[model samples]
Target: QLGIVTATRDDGFVVRTLNPGGSPLYSVSELPLKLARKCLDVFGTASYDEESSIHSLNTGYDDEVSSIYGAREFCLLRTTSGKVLYCGKPSALGLKQGGNAGSRWQELIVAKAPKIAQVAAGHEGLHAVLVGDDGSVYFTGTARRGEDGD
Candidate 1:
């Protein structure tokens, strides 16, 4: 299967696709000129010389975006404000809001921790783990809570 990676920049975002052999398929910036100006404005003239903080937007299958067996793929996004969003096929046990024909990005609600630092989804895209800045971990998706019979 193919793999896709999305990274956030000071200005905008970047997306890259890879072939089954892991070779580069194509790379594109969400917005080039606007991103450049945004970077400059935030970091000043030294922005060019400085490194932009990059985060690897991972899929439910860990680092890879798409599944090799043709299962539905899901992408995770973390905003600057620490909000986590999900985009892809809907899971029966996952949050069910914010999905439409044109967009699938949905806000994942963590009762224990509203602010998330990172998140990882299962290969089946049915379960996920979230880590908060305070070092607390939370679980969501199709997994049943507690024992089977409670």
Candidate 2:
């Protein structure tokens, strides 16, 4: 089965996950431009030295965005516009989100270099962790107010 991603402008997204011994599952679509902008608003400003388009913007994350599980991990991200972004890892769990951005919210970048099992979204930012046999929780994206410290 093939997993297909779908996206909407003002509304959320839905994706179709095709798997064996399972029914067709519809989920959110990929990060579309409009949706990307909504996400950016929540983060802060969309910075572009020169390589940037005015319509929509997004970044998976660089060597930044950390998870308690490991360094250079992708946490959940609240783009400037309020769109929710998540990395395809484990299945979506209790994953909860609200209207407030963390006092020190950080960007969520999914690390694709290594295979991921699951990921989740939180207040300040996003949190991601690898799947454990016994099922213990890992940590990521714990932003404080400011550097001087909030």
Model 1, stretches more than 4 Å misplaced? 1-34, 37-73, 96-102, 112-114, 144-150
Give me the overall lDDT of model 2. 0.35
Clashing pairs in 1: none
State model 1's lDDT: 0.46
| Residue lDDT tens for model 1, 1-150 | 343545566544544443455345443323323344221122212111122445332333222122111113344556555676655544533556433311234555677685677766666655666679899887665655441123
Model 2 lDDT tens row, 37-149: 33331222222112233332244433322232211223243333322244322222223443332122333333332333344444433333333323544444443444112
What would the TM-score be for candidate 1 when compared with the true structure? 0.41
Which structure among the candidates has the greatest TM-score?
A: 1
For model 2, the run of ten residues with the poorest summed lDDT: 41-50
